[model samples]
Target chain A: MNDLMTRLELSALQDRYVSIIDNDRMEEWPTLFTEDCLYQIISKENEDLGLPAPIMHCDNARMLRDRVVALRNANIFEQPVYRHCLSGLEWTGDGADGYRCQTSYVVINTSAAGESTVFQAGRYLDHVVRTPDGLRFKSKRCVYDTSRVQTLLAYPI
Target chain B: MNDLMTRLELSALQDRYVSIIDNDRMEEWPTLFTEDCLYQIISKENEDLGLPAPIMHCDNARMLRDRVVALRNANIFEQPVYRHCLSGLEWTGDGADGYRCQTSYVVINTSAAGESTVFQAGRYLDHVVRTPDGLRFKSKRCVYDTSRVQTLLAYPI
Candidate 1:
């Protein structure tokens, strides 16, 4: 694909990923990733320090599915609506490894009581590859700025 | 222009807008809008209720320039840095009315002490038109989801 097309596709893919999560379509979430993928949410402090500690980590598609299953069944927490606002998409690399990209994101959570709060503010460091189906994530890392997490992060950011 | 190019241009325009604000280039802000333009920051609640109340509203370029002057010279408040994260840019209208566009935004405030916090979450509803100076906003409306204002909004988000 051409550069603009690639950007548009990648942008759409990012938007779709957030839309799925925000709209509670978790079951379809794993389909956007490769079978062997790494998805982690880590703090900027930990990441900058190379601590390797992540708030949540899933190494494979099955693990991602399992997390979704747990969220739907085993996990118990107050249900809130999530709205992700993303920006600053920049494609940094392209070649045999596909495309290395980064984008900024801010997620807002609204409680069942209708109180909206800024839940998380961060950036996504992504490695995306073109598949027969489309573009899927090979790896996605969320690095969040430290300020306040408010409460338990029951959902993927 | 083609749709993709138009989108690309608009996306860059949005990014530039934030960069100017985040980087404290207040003098150039009004230039992003047409000679006669409307800019307002309103809460989503009031927007949905059809109330015209806005935290800040500017009509015409002169008013925008005047606000910038006040912010730079007259306003007295905490000096915090702003970082805006934006996403989901969509063009909703075109033709003589210009391009009606929308994009989600989250502003993070970092105090001089280097403490970062999620300050405001909102979406920009913009109407952009092609002019001699490239593309400029004919109208820009910020509809914010307010659970907390934190403190005085000294700078434009």
Candidate 2:
């Protein structure tokens, strides 16, 4: 596809990725990724400073699967919804078999049941490709700088 | 100067800026910037996500000086030292009689009575120029990504 089409596809993929959590469709979350993938939530400071730790890390598609399963069955937390706002999609470069895009995002949580708050804000450094299933992520790095999340992040942002 | 020498000068300038903070010479911090400047601490997410909020902002030399004075005479928090670690300095391009660069950093804080903890991590998106006062920053955007901060950031990171 051309650059414009490629960008359009990537945009749709991101929209679908976030909509799953926003609509409580956690089961389908992992379907947007490659079989072997990485989903990490790290502080920008750590990445920039070359630190080797992440707040949340799903090393493979299986790990992401396990996380959702745990969220559904094991984990316990307040009932809330996250509205993720994303923009600033700039092309970084071509990856091994895909393209990389860097974006900034803000995840706002409403516990109108409690209080509305800006939950998480950061950058999404992503690598996406045209998989058989369409544009899927090889890696999605959610790098935030909130210092403290309003509550626990029970679902993917 | 050549690209190599220019880069070296920028590196030294950064090193000096952080050292001034680490050594408790907070009063001297503002001298590193041009008279009219923008020093903002914002999340990469906010910038990328297109949000118009800053965690900390010193919009001009006056504001920066005000911050240092407040840090010294007004605000109260943990008495600590910050050791800034920086890397990833890539020259973006030449600006109007200056240069722009992007860098990653980690600020480690140590209280007088305890061990050090990583206070913040992020990138330094900066604009520098050869002013009459030597190499100085026209703008310094400290964009970090940490979901939660360790404590209140009273000093410039």
Number of the top-ranking candidate, with TM-score as the measure:
1
lDDT (10s digit) by residue, model 1, range B1-157: 2666778889899999999999999999999999999999987778879999988888899998988898988867877789887776767565466798877776778888888866776678899998988889999999876545677875677
Task: Looking at model 2 chain A, report the run of 10 residues with the lowest lDDT sum.
Answer: A108-117
Q: Highest DockQ among the candidates is held by which one?
A: 1
User: For all the predictions, what are the DockQ values?
Assistant: 0.16, 0.02
Model 1 chain B worst lDDT window (10 residues): B88-97
Q: TM-score for every candidate vs. truth?
A: 0.66, 0.51
Error of 1 at B147 (Å): 3.2
CA lDDT of A46 in candidate 2? 88
lDDT of 2 by residue, B1-157 (tens): 2544566678789889989988999888999999889999886568779897888988789999988888888766776788876544556466466888665566767777877755666667888988878899999998765546567877887
How would you class the docking of model 2? incorrect
Provide the TM-score, chain A, model 1. Answer: 0.95
Q: Model 2 segments beyond 4 Å from truth?
A: A1-157
